[model samples]
Target: MKTSSRLEKAIKKLYVAFHANELNPECCKHCAVGNILNNTDSWKHLSNDHGSLELNYVGKVHQTLGRKFNGYSPLELLQIEATFLKACGYQLPLHHKNKKPKSSADKEALFNGLTAVMEYLCKLDNINNIMDYSKLFEFENEKPKYQLPY
Candidate 1:
């Protein structure tokens, strides 16, 4: 499903929030920017047979949003991706550049990257404010070690 301009903007916001929080953005292997987005090195896989916590986190996000959309909607899937990355410490580097070409392909890449980043930040903000427990299911790691919500 093609993302609308508003959805793309939401992703960009996520990237900015992650950067402000000092995290770097990670990419999905299935996506266009997967090569540049940070890979899952800092995080651990809970179990080999169960497909790891990361996959489970993704699935949880899909399931949570799936109920609302009646399956994995593209935007919801991207939002879920962002949520996990945020929990796993995936953030957007302030110095990172949007090297997308002058085409829709570039737009899509930008949209995906930013979308994932933004949703994560949003969930974090919600959790910190005690407003939403929407992300509790997808969180795989312990609470931030030294980081405090500010």
Candidate 2:
């Protein structure tokens, strides 16, 4: 199935953020993107088997976005990765940190990339505003509290 152009653009923007090492948030255990990037097993397999990290990331993104938008095929994911990587001028194995943006350009790229991801997420959830994506994060963070049997 063909994804929308807007979704494609969002993916490209996210790839740029990933390439720039600007997407790692504090406590990757709570961040979808961070989990994919820091997966040692996946990286090891990728190195040994010549596997595609891009596909791995896309699969994680698809799962995180939920079953409502789980129609992407491996070929479509590869195409998205190819388009993004082709415009990148760096090598793989991106190194990320939690430091602030070093410059205006860095800040701009980060903002654009984050907005793109949020936009795509909102579309998936049928939300009207990008900011609404934050609610999803909040919901995820709020696991059901356990209590002693009354």
Candidate 3:
């Protein structure tokens, strides 16, 4: 599937961050949107609260002005961060009293989070989920229902 240049770059950056153990849903500079924006914490200013999809005044102005950070709008960035945090076992609008993962470095949790983020990214690009494996289960009359084009 052909992906937009922005989507391609975002996926490559996220892949490296995931493998390098740099992805952290709680850190402004290491979250999904952060990594997609080159690990900068600037995106955090888009929202008054971390993991919030609602844009603040500054964010609203940017959104109205058609500003995009790394090909994503302020609201889109917030949504991406929220998606990552939720999949990483964090409750919405993260707070000190909110439920969280037992360990910060849980590989399974991180993998799940990344998978979810990747799916969301693909969805934003209007493409098939690259991580989908459901086709492997497709069968007809004891034969594979689908064949790999490659």
Candidate 4:
């Protein structure tokens, strides 16, 4: 998906904050742009403190090019991750409006795409959850294994 410049810049600022010790990396967990885009908790904290950093950059090529961000708490970062995951591709059965169910091939394609993207992000973070994302299709009970308590 083509991301807005604002969203892109906001994401970059969040990363820089982590690099500069201005923000705690642990708070953001997976700090990569892909992860941040896929996860909402990080975006929320960053946005709440920084005020729609993404929206601000939507109009400019380098909105957050060199700015420092502040005010993210650990819990907010976690929330961002959850939201991002949902946005990226966590399917909601209820949201399926069409009477037609997904074909096996379609299901495979969706699962494969989500797994591929998530696996890539995990690799960037050196996180060991690649298997988790890859196995999301077969993951029973629709429950995430590493369920961080809110």
TM-score, one value per model: 0.21, 0.30, 0.93, 0.24
Candidate 1 TM-score to native? 0.21
In model 2, pairs of residues that clash are none
Model 3 ranges off by over 4 Å? 148-150
TM-score of candidate 4 versus the correct structure, residues matched by position: 0.24
lDDT (C-alpha) at residue 137 in model 3: 81
Per residue, candidate 2 scores C-alpha lDDT tens digits across 52-96 of: 344355455544665322243333333322222222221223234
User: Across residues 1-150, which tens digit of lDDT does each residue of candidate 3 receive?
Assistant: 799898899989989998999988888888888899999999888888888888989999999999989999888888888988899999988787889999767889988888998899899999999899899889999999989878
How many clashing residue pairs are found in candidate 1?
A: 8
Best by lDDT: 3
The RMSD (Cα, Å) of candidate 2 is 14.1
Alpha-carbon local distance difference test for all models: 0.36, 0.38, 0.88, 0.36
Locate the minimum summed-lDDT window of 10 residues in model 4. 50-59
Model 2 steric clash total: 0
In candidate 1, where is summed lDDT lowest over 10 consecutive residues?
42-51
TM-score leader: 3
For candidate 3, list the clashing residue pairs, or say none: none
- Candidate 4: Cα lDDT at 37: 43
